[model samples]
Target chain A: MKNNIVEKIWQQHVVHRQAGFPDVLRIDFALLHEVTSAQAFAMIERKNLSVQNPEHFLATIDHSIPTRKNRHEIYDKTAKNQIELLRKNCQNHGIPLCDLDSSHQGIVHVVGPELGITQPGMTLVCGDSHTATHGAFGSLAFGIGTSTLAHVFAAGAILMKQPKVMRVHFNGQLPANTYAKDMIMYLIAQIGIGGATGHVIEYTGEAVTALSMEQRMTLCNMSIECGAIAGLVAPDETTFAYIKDRPYAPKGQQWETAKSYWQSLSSDAGCRYDQTIELDITDLQPQVSWGTNPEQSIAINQVIPFSNKTKESLDYVKLKSAQSIAGLTIDWAFVGSCTNGRIEDLRVVADILAGHKIAKQVTMYIVPGSEQVMHQAQKEGLDTIFTEAGAEFRMPGCSMCLGMNDDKVPPGSRCISSTNRNFIGRQGTGSITHLASPATVAFSALAGFITSSYAEQQPQKEAS
Target chain B: MNTAIKQIKGLCAPMMIDDIDTDIIIPAQYLTQTSKDGYGQYAFSRLKQADADFVLNQQKYQTAKILIAGDNFGCGSSREHAVWAIQELGFQAIIAPSFADIFSNNARKNGLVLIDQPLEICELLAAAAQQNDLIISIDLVNAVFKTDQQTFPFVINPFFQHCITEGQDELDYLCSHLSEIKAHHQNAKGQTIFLAGAGVAQ
Candidate 1:
């Protein structure tokens, strides 16, 4: 039978398939994070299981770790205990962990791809939902809960039904000033929050091909946001080139074998998908969330949408359907998350803030995704550009994304953020988040409102 | 022999909001605890505090055992704490038109039965529960819910229904096939990095 990329990979790793149950799909790699791994460790312990294949897993700390100047002290007792628990659990289970003390520590998603642990065609699982970010490498990756994580801990497998496939073919030149973040946001808004529920998405066409690997990761990172189990872009030259020399990647002889094997992993010609949605983005605008959810978004030029659901969102966000969001004043600007906290995202924001001072009274937070991102941003002087522009550049973790740590938006303050979700109280209780591309967040922070692009930004008005 | 589900009987409350994501169900601030049991207090803490009349906070529905919601319920984040919170707060099941895939998987593992009803049926259920705390009974084996007004059927994956009803453990089942799993590493070539073409030792 002819098969799409997902089908090809699913068939290969299905170790067990009962009549009516979902396939017992084998997991090639797994990641454990501080917030979700502790309970999973407890579950493993309860089951009297030892780590079956410890070499196949790597653990890291991200969520609930402070990114503040005083991060080393771990002021929150709960955060400190969770981190310590993950450390002890990894040690007890014989799993390799990038503890707070390890240079490898970062957001679990960021750490995986950067160190080359992510590769094409692997079925990867992580306890955190952003594990879909690794699908940028053509892997069949998705997030799982602690039970599934422990299942993999003991069996190196998970029970998952093959999701129906939807091909989101983006067939047009990417409009200037628009990034992969814009493309994904537009797709989610068009499809609603539940648009692709119970589906697996494979991004294709001209627009997808043009995005860099980092950008491809950005496109796939929010797969969970649109309700897809995972998202994929077929591995091509860009994908291969990106993985060629990273630390954990296969070396010389194996690289030859891996490359040839990966080359054959794309969807076979004439294979059928359960559904296909075509999008033309020649004129797509930079997107920003006007309401409280990622799907409550519009093109920078569009008005806050009108609907009963959107009305509820608008009320929560304290906005009207009155005008464009381009000039609505915001209290904070955050430029980081698993969604847009990569090097390319930093470079874009750095360029926007190079000589510009952020607007007065507008707090700006620029957080890298990992320690590697921290050093790379400094090496490229992105940190200097950020600090001089008056944005706070903090140590790397999932800083301000979910804001479980020391960083949080004060209650009732509105923020332009480059994170994925804008769910109620996601950034903090009573705080509001507007999701946008890093470029949009950068320009908006500089202008003190939700600006579409730097070119359309207002001249900074110093507060009297 | 089956570890059959005891009939789950309870009062159902309505939270008809679409996309009631896990973050809202249990906020990230509540997730730092390594213990799973205490999250019930934090469940919907943000919503209940903001709105004085939220359903779960209502005098009538305080002990509600079944919660009904709109489409894509339990969406966002793979945090099992969301499931734990609802279960701890004494919710036995979530009835929805649809659910996010990750949340559904998490729900199954914890015996937090997820019943799939059409949006119209869900709306009906939610609307009825709003007027009065509707007592409902779930029969997982039969795949239907019994309300005082009527009996409505629901769709659930058989595996989940079986596992939740029987309280069966999938880990032990998967562990029974350890040899098969090791062989999969050998056969799933070029698809893994650590194993590469060099398979894992049996």
Candidate 2:
């Protein structure tokens, strides 16, 4: 119990502790976005409860706010109302609000770390599932609902049940063309989507250590896909270096003290986990989810399972067992989401689609995860490359990913997307989604089908 | 307060297929309504497509209060509508190999018990529901479930288990000790007024 960060944090803020249940874990940081926080703040007003700790809570407008313009009235009326509510709530509650025009404004998960608000050895909660993305800094972060969001707004505390721990160890070196997105997809496919259910997964071993802070974030971002409460990578020099110059990071001696504490937060040697999964990073390739769930994935080089071989899975996806995904036509190709919509994702997609044109039948869309990322992509001319390839370069938002905005696929349309979930009607009513990494999505867009870029180009080079 | 007897019990037919997302559970289109009523009728309506073969359309499964689902039962957005729809559809419990983290938490907080069993066990329950009129008795006090095929043990988070067993909402539970809270506030207020303590008053 002493080894748990949740316990440590709980002890610091213990007004009272009851037996037979996990301690009422007091939250230190409550990160919120416009989509969920607007309703939660409304509930708080109705209850007449003031925020207990205003400084600890932060808000940003992300989901519905369009990336193109800063003009508030240009958006849909509902989106305009949501943003207004968030602004009004923050003003009333005395909490910090990172509005669209602010330099720190971005995706809630991205903005938190870049501003150094997401620090090591902290317990962070957000109203979005991708809050696990903050765990890259060695913090315990997970999503909470609007009701719980209201609770945090009022009291800055939450009651939590301790989750069983699972340590995912990835050793050896990663192969070329393999990225953090591929690494997570491989883990989900290997373990199955439910493999880490009811468990908090700790990503460790050499491969995790070798990753940069941004890469580590991408790994933790998709922990929800595997049914894990959250995923963490123990903080190290890389994490410290990333936060050293960030705006909110502690300064001077306080920073040193924070580092010393972070160093001691790692799991002790010989510490036992409820489950341990090992993977060789060298064997991984870019992975794609061929079926509805993230676990129904295969390596870029592999073929979709034959219907007889995947009778159960085929029934769910409505595909024949022998139908190879290679050359299978697609209607739409989308590249963006909290999952793989970062600056690096844009750079990679641009690199792949640089001189190529998208197939006539396939309609492609490239949405940046945030305004900052969109600006960065524009500075690098990635937007031009995407547009030249016959892909629509859309404004930043959670566009086409969850169909929360106007961007959505029509029913029965099959789309290769870089977003997280591929559940039925996730994009729109009856839209079929196949989740993939950015590179796979780009290549599939060019080929007008689910084909691998590496495989298609490899044979041509060898023959030449 | 007296213990309320659970009015509904049975083996629930699998309403939707695998990876049933929050949108399908309750679409965002219906989120405009302020009240949590009338959602049950629209729950899984998109998937039913006016077809009687849809499980929710069946007469026997209409009143079922439990749901048995495949692996990764609720994988998608963190919309609480999914939990609301399940509860509005009258399901008190959902048994699955796994659930989306946020969905499970929302389900528990809203008094819906989400049970995570192994895949094989879920498949067994799903089969039982399909084969015949399967009856499942969920004893909240004992934390045990008896199905036609077998009796299985399901574990709920102790804190949530307490809340559900006591039939107390979280807000009510926290507000129950208002007198003690009020007395403490009064004493602090008096100290501040009298300047009897060094602690600063807001």
Candidate with best lDDT: 1
Report the first chain's TM-score for all candidates: 0.97, 0.90
Least well predicted 10-residue stretch by lDDT in candidate 2 chain A? A455-464
**Fnat of the models, one by one?**
0.64, 0.19
Q: State the lDDT of candidate 2 residue by residue for B108-184, as single tens digits.
A: 66778777888888888877788787778887767778876577888767677677777756644544434443343
Distance (Å) between predicted and true CA of A301, model 2? 1.8
**All candidates: DockQ:** 0.53, 0.21
TM-score of 1: 0.96
Candidate 2 overall lDDT versus native: 0.73
Output the TM-score of candidate 2. Answer: 0.85
In each prediction, how many residue pairs overlap at the backbone (N, C-alpha, C within less than 3 A)?
0, 4
Q: Please tell me what DockQ candidate 1 reaches.
A: 0.53
What TM-score does model 2 score on chain A?
Answer: 0.90
Docking class of 2: incorrect
